[model samples]
Structure formats: structure tokens, C-alpha cells
Target: MLAVIQSSIREYPLKPQHLLPLALATVLIGCAPSPDEELNATLPQLSLKELLPQAVANEYCNPKLDSDLLYGIGYQLYNDDKPEQARSCLIMAAPTHDRALCYLASIAEQDSSKDSAERDRQAFGYMAYSAVKNDSCAEFGMFQNFTYGMRGQTPDIDLGLRWLERSARHGDADAQQTLVRLHSNKGNLPLAYSWAKVLDDQAQIDALKQRMNPQQLSEGEQGFEQLSKIVTSKDAVRKEAREENIAVYSANIHMEYPETFKGLSVAERHALMEQAVATVSARPEFSTRGQFYAYVIIAQQAQLKQTGVDVLQNPQIVELLSDTELEVSEAVKKADVILGQAAL
Candidate 1:
């Protein structure tokens, strides 16, 4: 599931001196508006669902459709700011679709009506349901609820800490980031370094390095090696791809080529290019957007060589390659290294 909470709702003052302050000073000047308030301001005057026909809604809730397809449709609808329609599709997918459940919980949490207590209860129930299925975001939500106390529940720090660790291990970025600070504040630099390394936060790694002596740094490195085996950035990459609509684009790729793309129409060729773009963008190995496009160019060239169909001839492909923002040569070299590793 996409990480629902960007900024934490409640800041746990575990070790105040060791806590990292907000980088932007202006954000601290006054009472900042809640995340819900910020979200409400940006929402469209009319929902996308309001414009669509009733048949579309019925189709989304169709029992004949695959759960994955239903969830994907719901995911797109939710991101497109049509929560009411999204909720219907999500409900159809239900308990089997854990990420859909998370999205539902997020939608419920945004309710500001007088019966919001009931909404909170429903939201908490959704998170609890998904958490047991090992959904990282749900696990993180459970950690937040248990640690801070919500929906008339009492705070239990010990239980919350356990959930936090579980969430981090499951590759929830927020939980890992929280652990980095918590461990650092508690003077466990090795554990802190392990998580920071997992996140590939160069600044945090560098800062942590400066604070450690040779022995501590060595131990941190050893800890990182061990931690990395269990936690990967792929989960983070997948979440990012979903939020950016890259997953939807990738899903459009037709892997089974009955005929060469060269024989296809202009629209089909454009779609082929989009598929190639999506493939590269969804990969975790590419470090930057420039690198992603560069790799796509390389991959497309390979495809042309193998199938004798020049997808790169498509206008969309040509336009993307023409952009000066891409660092082609260097990124291609790095991508080659990743390719070589996979080949081994």
C-alpha cells in the first residue's frame, strides 16, 4: 500500500535532544494545519465519479472481475481523487486485498463528521485486519495507534515498539525512519546506521558516520550487512510506483507479442513506448528518473535488435530521448553494472 501518512500525526518525544528537527524553519513558526486540512484544500470541486455513468460503478463492483484488477482500479480511482467510487471497488475486493483495505482505512480517517468516532473505529478495524496479513503500512498504522492511543484505546509503549520494529522489518519507510532516530537518540549508533543505510539516506549516513569512531563505524557496517538481508528498498519502490501511476502504466505492457510492434498503428506504438518507460521506472535498481529513462532507451535498443521493430521511432519515445535532462551515458554505465549483476 502507498504510505498513507507523510508527516507523522503524533511526534513521540522519545529522546528530545537526539530527535532530528524539521529542516525547514518556516514550518515551525506557527500552528501548522493538519494533513487532513491540507488534503481538503487540494481536492477537486467535483469528484471524478460524479461525471462517470452508473454502469461504470456497477462494473467496478462486478464479482466476475479479478480481485487484483478490482484493487488496481480502486487504486487508480483513489489516486485520481474519487474516494467514493474507489471505496466501492475496494469494498468489492475486501479482506483478500490488503492494500485496498489500507486505502479504505485512509479514506475513513479523513472523515470530519460528528460521527467521526465511528469512522475512527472502522478505520482502526481495517488497519488491524490488514496488519495480521503482514501489510507494512498497516503494521505501521497499528504502531501509531498502539503507541499514541486512538479510538478510546490506551497507549502501550512496549506493544507499540514491537509493532514499529515489525513494520521496519517489513520495509515500511516511515517505521524505518522512525527507528533511525529512536536508536540514534538512545546511543545505539549501529542500529541507527543499519536503517539509514537501508533507506539510502546519504545525508543521514554521513552525519551518523561523523559521530562514530572507527569501532562503532565498523560495527555499524556489520549491522547494515545483516539488516539488509531482511529489508530491501523494493517495497519502497513499489509504493512509489503506485503513487506515481507508474504501476498502472507498467500493467499496460503487453508481454506476449503476437506480432511485432512495427506492424502496429501509431497509437499502439505509443503504448509500446509507454510500456518500456513504465518497466524502467518501476525498477528499484535505477537510482534516479534520468537513469530510468536512460535504461529504457538502452532496453528499447536491445528490443529493436532482437525483434527488428524500432519502437524508439515512436514520437513519444523520440520526445523523451530528446530531453536534455537525462544523464544517458553515466546512467547507462550504472544500469549495465546492475544488468551484469542480475546476469550472474
Candidate 2:
């Protein structure tokens, strides 16, 4: 079964241009700029308040400043070693942004200034909120919180595993990877194979095959089929589409403006791109699903000198834009399919 799937999957091997020079790699890997230095170089010289206004701060889920931009800014600030600023922005974003809440939980957990009890309380609070919102990362965080026993909670391995499974079902790569290892370690080869198949970790799958008999492998294949449908359902597809859209847009922007992004870490670059996408998303003209697709298409065609006119010319885009009845999820699926085709 694994071999059959592997045969059909397209391999995207790394190209020569993808590799950094050995000297440059050494400098980046061993002697990268300090957080402060990176902050000064990459970010504009503006006060936090100027970048994020008090009015927006006061409003939870502010329409003027959307959650994505707030989270993006907060994420960048956190990466730049400015936890205080990150906390402020993340708090504002957390009402509607699960990832922001998860970040807040992490920030609280890592704060040396806080007492352990206080840290646990804050971390648990943020994680709980994010979990309610169905954020896979937060679900995984909750699993950790429960497994380790926080300030007000006792360790419950059963409950932790439940959360871990929930996170895996919600399409968290980390959670899926962890489940594969946990099950494999516990001699549950069938369960392990199911998750490994979902993750497309061919090496792990192959290793598990060596351990499992034919019956166990067949059961695993059945589990994989069931899990695939759940993970590839409409909600999951929309979640994946939104993430990929931001990632591709960000990568395109980085490619187009390498000088502006020089010396930035991958996380930092993605943070900046998130903010850029948020800004573009907030524009009135791009409010509709069709318009958003157009923006993404333009970004995708950055090196090709493709203009808005070219994007508008796309038949799928035209059809999508014309369909006023399409729900966001449907539109998202359509857009993702279009993007996948473009990639090919």
C-alpha cells in the first residue's frame, strides 16, 4: 500500500539554487545576527504603539486591525526577542486567532520572570481558549499541559493521549509525527503505521513494515483510509488552504524582495509575509474570495511578470468570482485546486 502511494506521489527534490554556499551557511548557522541586531535591521524604526494603535489594542477582534496582521506582528516580535510587545499584540489577536493564543501560552510558559504557578495558570488559560477554537497546536499544548501536570491539574496520561489524538485528527503535523513514534514505541505497529502513512514518512512506514506482520499491515491500511477522509474533509481543506495561501504568498514576496529579507530566519521571513498577506487581505478590493484568489495568483506569478489582467483572465478565477453563492469553504477548496494546478 505504501509503495503504491509512493509511486503516484510527485517528488519535489531540492534544486541546486535551494542550497546555500558552505561559507554562507556556516555564517548563518554558526554566527547569525543577535535578535536585537536582526530586529534593528529587519523591522522599521517605529514605536510599538505606532505600529499597533491603542484603539486597536482596546478592541478585541478589531475590524480595523484584523487578527492575522496582529498575530503576524506578534509572531515577529516574539522571534525578535521582544516578548512584551509580542504579548500585547498576541493578546489583541487571541480573541479570534488560535495561533496567537498558542503563542501567548508559550510566552507565558517560558517567562522566567513569572512564578511557576502563575506561568502555568497563564499558559493553561491561553491553551484552553485556543483548544476551544479547535487549534491543533493548542490541542497539542493542552496534551503536554495535562501529561506533565500543571499548577492546578494532575497528570492524566489518558486525557493527554485523547488531546494528542484530537490534535492529530485536526491535521497537526507535529501531533501526527508524535503519535507515530509513541505508538511504534509501545508496540502498536498497526496504529503507528496508520499515522506514518498519513504523514507520508516513508522511512517510518518502511521501518514499521519490517516490524509488523501482514494482518497488522492490512489493519493499518484500513485505518489510514479512514483517517485520510477525516483529514481531507472540507474543514481540513479550508484550514490547509488558508495556511498554504499565506505561505506561498510570503515565499513569493521574499523571492521578489530578497534584499529586504536578507539575513532573516525562515520563521522571521514567514512572519513578515504573514503581515504582508494580512495587509493585502484587509484591503477592501480583495475582500471577496475571487479577489483574494486574484491577489494570490499575482503573487504566484511574481517572477513571470504576470499582472492583475493576467490573473483576471484565468477562467477558473472568473467563474469563482461570478459565483456569489459559493461559501467560503467551497471557494477555498476551489482556490486551492487552482493553486495546485498552477504549481504543477
Candidate 3:
């Protein structure tokens, strides 16, 4: 055990005159909450009334201006028609919101007096940050700015398309619609059909079908073939299955000896799963992860017991399942073929 001497500098005696200032300094050094750098330095030194109107300061620091609460207050201010104040509040809460940076970029766009190039650069920086943080809306914002050059940057079609693709993958219907239009107008039917099929924009897809010859349609189907790999991955399937509260199975390693594995003849199931995994191992991307492939094969096997095998759509994928996109897709296709033949 240790005893500590609580002493101030000996030169500064314990005078009443010094007590208040020391207490104030303690508050400044310790209790004050300022997530913003500028405000952080000065707010602690100022009286509560001087820092903010007494009520506002009290509420801003109510429980404490924690990250979540600061975001809430800033979000509320934005909804209350106080966008300018909201910007200040949200800036202090930067990089965390229901996509606040995009909102800030929009607000910044209205400052017509700022130099156009500089203003666009500022907005672009905010949007780019938000996009990489996986804000679907910000990704879409980045897509537009890049595609059209509206933010003073030159049009970057390839980069814009990549952003747009990510935004669509994140389930922004608007981004999907843009992809549909872009691919359709460019006569890239296969890519367009992929987008259309995802969104179930059947009427337009049907119209496009009428114009395609068999080769064009076949080529179109193949063009977007690689895209579905994400959903078919073991991780995606497990997440979707868990969210739906579906039954999932354990692999041999996951359980010492699960009843399910025993019920299906452990040796046979393991052999079939390995065989299916071997088919995908032919692909380089998935060849390296042995155990991961086994987990995916187990997912494919689970689906086979019910109906068809689609590792991505398997409601019975194991909880701890993970696999590469290449492995998962190949596993599903190969497993379906293997299991389908076994059932027959």
C-alpha cells in the first residue's frame, strides 16, 4: 500500500485568496467538456454563463457533452431549422452521425461568397471522409460530385462509377437507379440487367430484353456474373441468417461432436464437404484458407438438407462462419452440383 501527500507548491500558501482560483483552475483542467479544439481551450476558463447562455451550457453538459449526446444535440438542432448552429454543434461531433458530414457539405455549399474552388474542395473533403466511413448517402454524394464535376473537380468517370457501385451495394435505391440508366444507355445490357434484377426493375429489364439477341443477352448475363459474389460469401449468409433467427449448424471443429454431424454420418458429410471445397480451391482467391472453406462447405450442406444450395441464401449457416467471396460462391455452385447428385 502507498500513501500520497496531497500538496500544492510550497510557495503558494493555502490562502483563501488562492483557493477560488485553484478551484477554478481545477475545473478548467478537469471537468470541462469541449470536443472542439477551439472551444476546448477557452470554454473551461470562462464562467458557465460566458461559455454559453446558462440554460444551453447546462444542457450541453447535462449528463456531459459525450460523443453520442453531442451528436444528438447537433442532429436535433439541424431538425429544428437551425442549420448554421447545427453545423457548429455537429463539427464538434465530427465523423459520427447519421451521415452528418454530407449535411455539413451541403450547408457549406450555400456560402456563395467563398471562392468556388476552395468551397468545393472543403465540401469534397467532408464528403470523401464520410464516404470511406461507409456512409451510403455520403458515398452517393461522392458519386455525383465525381461523375458530374459539380464540386469543381474534373469528371472522373471510373472513380465516380466505383463510388456509385459501392453506394448501390449499400442499398441506396437512387444509386441503383442511376446505374440502371447508365448501363442501359451505354448499351451494356448485362451490367444493366444485373442492376435491374437487384432492384426488380422488371419493366425496364423486359424492355431491354426485347432489344437483345441471344449472344448479347448471354454476354450480358456473364458480364455481371462476378457481382453476386459478395452476397454469396459465408459471412454475408451467416449475418443474414442470424438477423432472421434461422437455424444454423456447427462444423466438426466448432463442436466436439454435434448431434447433427453424427446424424448425417460424420465421415460421409465431412468427405462430401471436402470434395465441394476442393472444387472452389481451384480458384486462387479462396485456395489459401482451408478451415474457412470447410465452414462454407458446411453452410452449403445445411442448405442441401432443406432444398437447393445457395451459400449466400443459406438460412442455416453457422454463427461463426466466414469465407472469401471466391470460396463462398464456388462452394455454393459446386456443392449444389455435388449434393444434388447425391440426393438423386
Best by TM-score: 1
Off by over 4 Å in 3: 1-80, 223-225, 231-344
Off by over 4 Å in 1: 1-61, 112-114, 232-247, 250-310, 314-317, 320-344
Position 142, candidate 3: lDDT: 63
Error of 3 at 26 (Å): 56
What are the C-alpha RMSDs, in order, of all predicted structures? 13.8, 19.3, 25.0
lDDT of 2 by residue, 7-46 (tens): 2212222221212122224333565652223312421233
Give the number of the best model, judged by lDDT. Answer: 1
Per-candidate TM-score against the hidden true structure: 0.59, 0.55, 0.45
lDDT of 2: 0.59
Q: What 10-residue stretch in candidate 3 is worst by lDDT?
A: 1-10
Task: TM-score for candidate 1, please give it.
Answer: 0.59
User: Where in model 2 is the C-alpha error above 4 Å?
Assistant: 1-64, 150-152, 232-344
Residue 150 shift from truth in candidate 3, angstroms = 2.2
- The 0-to-1 C-alpha lDDT of every candidate, in the order given, reads 0.60, 0.59, 0.51
Q: Write the per-residue lDDT of candidate 3 for residues 1-344, one digit (tens) a residue.
A: 00111222122111222222333344346654411222123212322122122124332323234344455455555556666666665565563453656666775666577888867866766666666555667777766665667677677665566566666665666677776777666666666776776666889779878988888778656544544432133355344333212111222222222333444543555454455554544544343444354554555355548645555343333222334444444544555565456557
